[model samples]
Target: MKVKGVRLYGKDDIRLEEFELPEIKDDEILVKVMSDSICMSTWKMVKQGANHKRVPADVADHPVIIGHEFAGDIVKVGKKWQDQFKPGQKFAQQPAIPGQAESPGYSYTQCGGAATYCIFPNDIIEAGCLWTYEGDSYFESSVAEPMCCVICGYKTNYHTKDRYEHVMGTKKGGSIAILGGCGPMGLGAVSYALATDNKPAKVVVTDVDDAKLARANEVISVEEAKEKGVELIYINTADMKDPAEELKALSVDGKGFDDVFVYVPIKSVAELGNQILGYDGCMNLFAGPTDPNFSAEINLYDCHYNSTRILGSTGGSIDDMKEAINRAAKKEIKPSVMITHVGGINSIVDTTMNLPDIPGGKKLTYLQFDMPMTAIADLRNLADEDPFFNELADICDRHNGLWSAEAEQALFAHYGVK
Candidate 1:
């Protein structure tokens, strides 16, 4: 079989190529990718070029396959795998395969999911580590892996078995704010908050970009709060000289929001969210510093005196992915809303190289491999074949509507999507 995918061979360079499939070993199953989402991590890889940690040094000399967020079908089972596994099942899998040689404290593994076909060990199958969702499309199902990473991040920060368990105020009317709210992770926090059963008194989202803030409001349906008699404010954190003061101003009544979710890498939001936290307020850091060397200055005196708690989370865990999948299945949460662009695998390079120019923060873009033109006419057509796609397309359409179709086309064109 020929597998199609995006590969990086040098700095700031990615190519979509097809390759012959390798012989599958016993106890391994081969999956044909249904769809894959371009991610910030992949963006970082292309931006950094050859310096990315995840890009194997060996593959750096060759075209290394690069993608991790995706879902697919079990098309081929090895001789040993066939006895235990069946084909034609939907599965969302992790790409963190252990390398052949153990390096220092880390186990060596060659793993990735960007290719059209890849193999998974029987352990992953028997353990149910590969998620099986009956209702999710392959494209939408791929998001479960990303959701698992979010769950992992949630677990890292809070001690709760489930982060959704903590309802700030009422089941549907709690108070929350997301700082640097115009990014993907920020967008994820927003989705989680809205999808949670706990209601908020208000959900105030802020961003430096008026355009992005506008879109955030639409995607989350924050405006619907007005009809429901709930308070939701979409503000611009653009003018505030400092993140701390800016957030402090947002939290009226001398107490900050019941919950503050920081999406961008603004170090000050962490401190400020703590400073203005309500009596039992919880400020969560859904975003971290971009540079590993960066650290935020903390005033220990105030941090200890106030009952404020500051927490941070990253990538979802298996449990979190299950929860996210279930939530998505019920339409309680839709991850597709984050998708902003759609293109073929050939467009991956340009897309990652110029991500900022692309509109819609936390947008999910597709690299439709070998798909025909009739199926790829527009966002609406692109999403129609998939379940979660319509919701995601609706979110994109809402923002695309704010601008002229020509303008949206130009933006997509800049990323070589057209």
Candidate 2:
């Protein structure tokens, strides 16, 4: 079968082309990609291209599809796993295949969700990274991979005084701060921290843009945070005289925050997150920087006397993905909260290239190839120009500008595709 997808050849060299997919072997599976959420990591891979470690050296010769956060349906299964998986079943994946440096979407030449179809290699299948999904929408399932990474970051920052055993996760009933919390990944961390059983007394989310902060509040409302017994505060520190000092004052005793999550990989942001940690506070660098020698200053005196520690994580384990899936199923964590834009496969290239400039939570792409990347909020304005968008705007308005499974169904119906 021939499929259309955007492939990366080298740095700044991504092309959309149609190619023939080879037949699946006895140990492989063919999936029809339903939804793929563009991730910042994917954007970084696009920018780095051959220079990226996970990118295959021969990518310039044989281009590779670039995406990872995706959900789909099993169109065909290999003979070896015919009994385990069947056609028409919904599926998602962890994407961080255990031993492989480059998982599907980053390294695999024939596998990625930017296309109508992709193949699951035997290694991925055997590692059990692929999951059978049961969610409200493919968008939710696709974004579970990123949610898993968020969960992993929290889990990684676990520490203990005794050193014999350690508590894994943020301190309960403690003050927490999320730097650059308006972005999609930061928003996930904010929602997770607020909603989870590991309750924080207060969560102060900081960003430069007031619009993004307002969107964050809209997506994860104050009422929702109050219901969870969390005091959620959104702050724009762009013009603050001393943002770190102001953030520290939000804590109960004004000592500092218990857990600080740095969502942007910039040195200044990371240092600011470190500066606001209280005694025994743990700071998790949640974002991956493109620079190999990304360095930041640390207060060693605080680390020694206050027991402050810093950590960083790239992706999550398969188990973490399962946990995210379970939480999404139970409504403990809403993956849909991260989706702000929707479109089809044709939107992948432009969306991926200009992801940083695109002001939205997550850009979700369907394999249908007809729809352009359209923000749910923008549909209202589009309604004035086109009757098709008018119906979409109505659907989005009903959901308060948030993308839902119903809206997606309406879109597919509008496009006359499934």
Winning candidate number (TM-score): 2
TM-score of each candidate? 0.75, 0.95
- Give lDDT per model, in order: 0.57, 0.85
- Tens digits of per-residue lDDT for model 1, 260-288: 67676766666655665654556677775
- For model 2 the local lDDT of residue 267 reads 90
Error of 2 at 364 (Å): 1.1
**lDDT of model 2, residue 114:** 85
Q: RMSD in Å for candidate 1, one decimal?
A: 7.3
Candidate 2: residue 118 Cα off by (Å) = 1.2
Per-residue lDDT of 123-154 in model 2, one digit per residue for the tens? Answer: 99899988687776777888888899988887
* Candidate 2 residue pairs that clash: none
